[model samples]
Target chain A: MSDSIAIELRDVVKRFGDVVAVDHVNLQIRDGEFFSLLGPSGCGKTSSLRMIAGFELPTSGSIIIHGREMGITPPHQRPVNTVFQSYALFPHMTVAQNVAFGLEMRKTPKNEIARRVQEALDLVRLSGLEERRPRQLSGGQQQRVALARALVNHPEVLLLDEPLGALDQKLRKEMQLELKSLQVRVGITFVFVTHDQEEALTMSDRIAVMNKGKILQVGTPTEIYERPNCRFVADFIGETNFIDGVVIGRDGNYTVLETPEGLRFRGLAARPLSDGTSVTYSIRPEKVRLLTPDGALPPDGLAGTVMSVNYIGSDTRITVRINDRRIIDVWEQNTRSTLDRNEYWQPGEAAVIVCPPDNALVLSE
Target chain B: MATLQQQQQGRDRIRLALLLTPGLLWLVLFFALPLVIIFVYSFMTNDALGRVVYQPTLDNYITVFTQSLYINAYWRSIWTSVLTTVICLLIGYPLAVFIARSPQQWRMPLLMLILIPFWTNFLVRIYAWQIILANNGIINGFLELIGVGRLPLLNNEGATLIGLIYGELPFMVLPLYAAIDRFDFTLMEAAADLGANKIQAFLRIMLPMTMPGIVAGSVLVFIPTLGQFVVSELLGGAKVDYLGNLIQRLFLRANPINWPLGSAMAVLMMIVLLVLIMLYFRATTEEER
Candidate 1:
């Protein structure tokens, strides 16, 4: 992807009567990048995408698509296409006809339209089913037709609104990879909107986490997952154990946090923190190492009792109760096939859960 | 247990037969029997004294085909019915779409308004139109007060058309509403997103999807208008003569009542209606398949 911006939203706001669906937001998506708007339902992600597609007029801001200001331009006038969540395939048209509809609307030469339609059908692996109506296809097939119909136009940008939400679990996984590869092949900017965090993390080059009509953070998958700037992003992206604390001191790049129980913890702060500032320290379950009580203890390790041990085939998820009130989960991967079943941690056993200071995140929101 | 299953199946068949018998018997007795009697009567001649004559002859059929008066009435009926159906479609389509796209609370009320005219007697409604379209009626008087001068407003083909369209509008709107209410509007947005303007999207998506409604509404309006007698009699006075009026005069008003000629004309009209209905079914079924 180039450094040139393909779409830029500047102070964009959209209100539907009494409800502000998209609050004032500013963003810039680079050319050919697979960007995602990740959030729960009704979080203004779809509204932002619709504004970019010109389906909606921004109440008080500007949307620039490839350097052109999209001010109240109708959807048909914009150089963008959308794959709707409902897979809005024209029922009266065949697969080829549906794909050719956009080109026909633009009044392209008949032969050229046919060629592009065939090419798009081949891209989605639906070449042989060109003569069939949308009703004759399965859910996955219909979605492919919707994709091809939009892609055949060779639009400047493509917007997908939870396009894989209706598919089965296995099919959704396959299509996530398929859609990512398709974006790469076409070399077009894809602004995908999805509520499924795993789907966003798996497919997007960059993700903008949003909630309540505002964008929380925008970064790569690992950056957003590992160095989340707020509690909502950390909690929404993955399972995290939060321990409330007050910053007592600063140790170079790390902050020393003291819990109410007089337990001290040290972690890297997402932003600069002053002494005595209230903060919440978060650590992913997989980042904490679980050890036996008799093992060599790290200086910063907290002694706790194992409350529950769940062996879920791939990993052994153990919840360790720290101090009197705080319970933290530790995940241990099943990397070996030892014959002894007793190798697993038993309930009520004393355990030491150590979270390396570097892996801990101090979010002050 | 096998015998019990068979007995249950037999009872189900008998139940189906009992449910269908009433409708089937009504059609065969009141509909099919009359049609057969009319067909037979069309070939028999009436005596000069208006007495019954069972002698079969082709003279009545020849007269029906060759007489200019009967032929002119048939053509006029066809032309007027076509005109009425077209106008009804033009007016009803937009109204049906408006009602279908209306808010949830207003849809039923709007549809109810379309059907309120049916609660009153059909002939009474026709008479109401007669009073409204009369030369010295309320509309003409209002026009004169507005300085537009009194115009010839009634007892003409135009007045007959207005009455026919008003009476048949509800039939057209109901079927169109039913079809349009179930339409998927999201497809229109998809069209617009793919680079189609408002008019193109409507033509390419909405119109094709609602074809069934158009066909149904047109057929409903066309069939009844073809045989409409009261609208012409009340609005056209004695100046207009439609197939229905002609048939009524033949069987009931003519001296020594020409039942044979009336039966022949009725059979010919039935043939025309049957052909039109069959064409409609064929066209719709082809599209569905």
Candidate 2:
């Protein structure tokens, strides 16, 4: 199943009355790939997940899973399982019963169902918890039980909708890695939907960045992060400062930008902008360097005044106000200098911020 | 000043205790005391005047045990209440689920429709059913207007059973509606995604998850049905005698001297309902295991 397509969505359009939730989306998820639909709330991510689950049928287009077209095929007949955000475990049944329910539905042999349930529970590290009800377990353990309940069926695809949203930060992080390894161990295609960018970055093999009712970009985490196709994707993925300017010169792969404040800036050339065309340069705050006193190494740097300084463990973040117009954020690695971070930079003190030219992203629109 | 504060604290405790006393006293006097009295009466023998003879005998209980009359009434009441509860559950559970799973704008109106029957008097509703079910009533007229067979919906065992079910339907629906409204529907979707068919999901997931509401609705509909006098009187119309009718006839109509028998019947009915309620609670509790 390595190269086989597990699920395919072609021109899927879903409407709720007059509102269009998913607008003619086309996607193909390969077998064993951990794919994520990352978006903010109400961006049709959950709607797309629901369509694949057969809980909601698309107004048009086809949902093909494992080479079978699911045309209004009820959820029970689908060869896919979902782990819900709330971990909707059965309250009346023990963990073992909950896990065995799917096998019972499929008419598996009683003894075999029992054995398989035990194996699934063991995989989820819930060996001794078979007899406990859902309420007896903590949030994380219940989450695992939900996973075990779904995985016991060994469906071709697994849908997870915000499965880690209810977890605390530490548990969510732990579950992130656990879920990633579990997907690898099971070797099944996973379609995870979440609005958390870091969770997607850490866990997904391919990420689809969705906004509104359309997919803005779909790529590997590195590709999406290092080179976002649009401004929204870049801003949503991580922090970056945008400076609007006009293209002044083009030198093969490098371009010179002139901000309205008359500060000449250098940035990379992606899609070349014509000379004098309005554009924006995105510069990562961490790439900015604060020049020290005494004729520092940088001879050509933007002049500014240190407006504020914040100390965070291993880094000092200083904001430099430029010509009373723009502000550039610079992160300085702490070296435990003689001057305290608070004493080192005060408001209205002259400062210089510098970064390599290639670190800036050029945008035309 | 310290003494004054202490005095205020003492008075506060007194006020709090006073606030709790009325409800406690009501429970003890109206509920707990009556149950204890029934407990004593179940063990004692009564004379013809309905006065306690002060003689310790299980003769009344023995009569209840040996007499086929009392035994049949006891069994019939239980069976009728069971049938009522089951029918209500079969009908109300789905209705509640449909309402709860419906779109947001429709939820409140459908819930109000379920609850509107309860806004007025249940007795009045039973009377209305009487008018609708009686021979040559509006129902029969309509049936004739449509040229259909006449229905025997009153003055029969089946008619009383139907009344029992109808009277208890709302009770069943309200509890079930609460359960369904609070139900996390994602579990059903999860079950479906886990490759369980709709029947399996319903039996193993939905039904068991809604057990508390089912049990609550069952008990609420059952105990009162076992002892209800109005439905049997107005709808059954003396064609058959249920436990409630038998007790009433014994004390008030058949023979004034048979108050002992009525007391005995009341005591026996109480025991039967108590046992039934216990059995239902046990059955529901086992589901948690």
What C-alpha lDDT do the candidate models reach, one value each?
0.92, 0.85
Each model's DockQ score? 0.74, 0.66
Error of 2 at A133 (Å): 2.9
Q: Candidate 2 lDDT (Cα, whole model)? A: 0.85
Query: Which candidate comes out best when scored by TM-score?
Result: 1
> Model 1, stretches more than 4 Å misplaced?
A295-297, B1-9, B49-52, B280-289
Model 2: what TM-score?
Answer: 0.88
Docking tier of model 1: it is medium
For candidate 1, list the clashing residue pairs, or say none. none
Q: Which residue runs of candidate 2 sit more than 4 Å off their true CA positions?
A: A1-4, A275-277, A292-300, A335-349, B1-21, B31-69, B103-109, B118-123, B149-152
Best candidate, lDDT-wise? 1
10 residues in a row with least lDDT, candidate 2 chain B: B254-263
User: What tens-digit string does per-residue lDDT give for candidate 2 at B40-105?
Assistant: 665676565656566666777788779898788788778888889999999999998998889999
| Candidate 1: residue A219 Cα off by (Å) | 1.4
lDDT by residue for model 1 (A73-182), tens: 99999999999999999998898999999999999999999899999999999999999999999999999999999999999999999999999999999999999999
